[model samples]
Target: MGLFSKDIKTMDDLFVHTLKDIYYAENQILKALPDMIEKATDGGLKQGLQAHLGETKNHVVRLEQVFKMHGAKAEGVACPAIDGIIEETNEIAGEIDDKKGLDAALIAAGQAVEHYEMTRYGTLIAWARQLGRADCANILEQNLKEEKAADAKLTALAERGINAKAA
Candidate 1:
């Protein structure tokens, strides 16, 4: 169903729909990371992307747990937002020939993905709590915390030397 589909008649439905959205997004990230890891020229950036790939797996599992806890079918909806971000990243990465510049671009791409995730997770947490699903909210908080940390790490890598190297 679409975001504004009549199928989502209640707040709970919206929560479940969002859960599915993130579930799909995480899986997509899981698929995209290996390529990013391969493309990254900087050791630190590569390692960070690799680490996040592992965390993304866990995030998917946690989302499944939340689904079970909430008695919703574990599934995903099409997330155009993530798809667009990944496509943009790939397009940008392909255009940059310099390794250092590519590294910098990768970091920016990673941050874009993280920011999208952070927004979704934050909204999901609030919705989960409103639906009286604190347990789900708490589990989602774990994902949010990791996303925030990942974004910070990307920022740190950019500031530390990647951007300078690119320049």
Candidate 2:
């Protein structure tokens, strides 16, 4: 069955569905990052992608814990937003030929993904708490924190490093 296949018949259902969406997003990111890392020629950019890949693995674990806490199965609903973002990243990466400029594009793309994840995780944390799953909220909060950190790191890379090189 699909996420919307069933009516959002309960608060728990809504919560689980959002969890599943982000779970799918996180998994998609894991698949996309290797190419991002390989295409990123800057040492710092490569390292940053590697670090976020580790964090994304942790995000999957946290989502699983949230499901366990809520007595739901840890499954993914397709997230078209993430799929589009990954596709756009691939298109942009394919177009950029200069090594330094490509690194800049990669950083910009990475930050966009990070910003999207932060929003989803933030909303999920609020929903988890509203559903009276504080334990699940805690897990969601952990992912949110990591997402925020990744955003900050990407912002920094864009600000003083990659963007300058792209110019």
Candidate 3:
């Protein structure tokens, strides 16, 4: 259902819809990360992306758990936002020939993905609490914490030398 679908008439419905949105996004990120890991030129960048791939897998599991806890079907809805971000990342990565530049681009793309995840997780956590699903929120907080750490690692890699190497 669309975000504004008439089917979602209650706040709980909105919460579940967003939960599915992130579920779909995390799965998409899982699909995209291996290619990003392969394309990464820097060893550190490659390693970080690989590690996060593992975490992203856990994220999908956690989201499934949340769905079960909330008594909702464990499934995903189409998330156009994540689709656009992944598409943009692929287009940019394909255009860059320089290894250093590609590494830098990869970091940016990873951050874009992280930022999107952070927002969704944050919203879901809040909504979970509001809906009296503290159990679900606690589990989701784990995913959010890891996403923040991943984002920070990407920034550190960029600032430490990746961007300068590209320059």
lDDT of 2 by residue, 41-138 (tens): 88887898999999999999888887887788989989988999999999999998888899988987888898889888888888878877788888
Q: What is the lDDT of residue 148 in candidate 3?
A: 99
- Whole-model lDDT, model 1: 0.96
Candidate 3: regions farther than 4 A off: none
Whole-model Cα lDDT of every candidate shown, in order:
0.96, 0.87, 0.96
Model 3, span 35-142: residue lDDT tens: 999999899999999999999999999999999989999888999999999999999999999999999999999999999999999999999899999999999999
Model 1 residue 93 CA deviation in Å: 0.9
Consecutive 10-residue window with the lowest summed lDDT within model 3: 124-133
TM-score of candidate 2 relative to the true fold: 0.94
**Which has the better TM-score: candidate 2, or candidate 3?**
3
Cα displacement (Å) at residue 136, model 2: 0.5
- Per-candidate alpha-carbon RMSD to the true structure: 0.6, 1.5, 0.5
Q: Is 1 or 2 the stronger prediction by TM-score?
A: 1
User: For every model shown, what is its TM-score relative to the native structure?
Assistant: 0.99, 0.94, 0.99
